[model samples]
Target: MSRISSFVEIYFPGVAQRFQKGIALIDERYGVKAMYGLFFNFCLNVSRPGQVDRLHCLPHADYKNLALAVCVVFVYGEFNHKEKCWLVMWEAGIILQIPPGVFVAYPSALFYHFNFDISNLEVCVTDGADFPTPQNSRRLDGGASGRGSCVWFNQASMWQTAEIGVDTIKQAISQGLDATCDNQAFLDSLVFAKIMGDKGQPQPTL
Candidate 1:
């Protein structure tokens, strides 16, 4: 996992630093202890790897939670963008060309995307990840074989997690905030918020 992270950081510098900061922010904001999990969360695939559409081109499809993409070789694939409908970029049903080394960064989870079929010779490798997304990540550093074993701390039971998200707290109340949210839960929540609020002023040296 570290090797893969290093390789990806080669093409996209500051990956480790930026993502490390992002992970910390998520953990802080959501009152959850999270880590990279240090896994290959992307794919290095061939051109037109998926099935072609009726038009014989890789039709408009949205990539969920994608952040960036890079074409390594002669991957000259055309791309089209649509918000909620099928619309070409330049001409009537035409798309924009993607030259090699012309890296693209976008929030794929928020937009619809279209791509044309690439020639067999044009191989591409895309690397991307969503930011600030919350997940129950395991403590990889403390485990043998670096597999999922230990959690940083039981967020639900250990941390002041009732203050994690307002929506979650409300939902918990609506459904059942029981077994947690004891008599002192409200004070604990407020104190937790105050402490975290006072923080984030100075960027801590990692």
Candidate 2:
């Protein structure tokens, strides 16, 4: 089997009406696996260490051999990278407008960062773990060292949060399901395909 080292984003349409059901479906589809959702009321600030406060890279690569998938319901912000700016996209097209509710997904491994300028926007994050360990090295310069102690961030630990559940995730998505979210899912899926080591699949040049 190919090594899984990327993230995936899945988008749900009409998320408001089907938020809770979706979570339930995911749970039923992938049982006993640790699933988590993070909701943000305002636009999130995701930047390199010195660039922003709310944004920070993890100490080590997550899931070592798996991918992370994020389902965003609403987006009132944009993702800023070193080379260019990416406006979140929906199923229809580029997400230049922000609706009250939108859903989008994307891989978490690509070399990119995001920031939100709007208030009260919500984000739902669903993740799985393949292996966990303590980090032997710190992310001093925006890069991770391959060797280090490792710790596992498993399902039990994630479910401990009150805000993480099918209902909560669904609520966040129903709040916003726009084009940006759709585009994110597409980009993320591309990354996921690569990590899965699909033969003949084109990988992102980054």
Candidate 3:
């Protein structure tokens, strides 16, 4: 996981920095603990018990996620990556062929994305040691014969708390204001607010 975090920071430096800032603010103000000592929360997805989707997901946008935040998705399985699972971004008309054990980072809140169906594809579990594996592996068996993904991201509410010092929706509700509209307005204000841009202030040394 540390290696994965480093990989993301290397490829998406700006996003990683923004995430760190937001997480730091929240930690100081609200005592929220960072997941795995990082700014992003993690989720693992896998095929249902006996049912096949093999992490093949439906098209959807994470509407309530931080607008400018990037989601780092790590794809893994034993299927043929070349012909099997692929990430599709509907808004950009982009289909990413993500090889197994590789990471792809994108702004999930801004795009409708999903994975290509891999249920119909046969799983080929290899023991040839051709697949990437941990250095401490005891057996020569290859990757798992089912698709799964590890996604790391920040919820918009986390950023909202970091920025406003409180949950805006709850505050709005207490004041008898429309929570939904207030939340949307607050999120719109942050869509391009530049969380890390220099604004006549000293930048923290990372």
Q: Best by lDDT, which number? A: 3
lDDT of 2 by residue, 1-206 (tens): 00111111222222221323344444565453223332111133333444442332332323321123333323222322221222333332332322222233432222143322222233222233534333332221212111111111222122222223333445555766321224455344343222223687565421
Q: What stretches of model 3 exceed 4 Å from their correct place? A: 48-53, 117-145, 170-206
Local lDDT at 44 for model 1:
36
> lDDT tens string, model 1, 23-64?
465566765544323221333333332443122224343333
lDDT of each: 0.32, 0.29, 0.67
What is the TM-score of candidate 3? 0.66
Candidate scoring better on lDDT of 1 and 3:
3
Which residue segments of model 1 deviate by more than 4 Å?
1-21, 25-40, 47-57, 60-63, 66-94, 117-206
Cα shift from native, residue 112, model 2 (Å): 1.2
Q: Which has the higher TM-score value, candidate number 1 or candidate number 3?
A: 3
Error of 2 at 139 (Å): 39
Q: What is the lDDT of residue 106 in candidate 2?
A: 38
**Which stretch of 10 consecutive residues in model 1 shows the poorest summed lDDT?**
142-151
Write model 3 residue lDDT over 1-206, tens digit each, in one string. Answer: 68766865766565567677887898788787777545457898876646764566778998877776577788877666755667889988988888878887788999999876343444443456677345423332222247778888778887765665556768856777554425455344442212344676543321
Quick one: ranking by TM-score, best first?
3, 1, 2
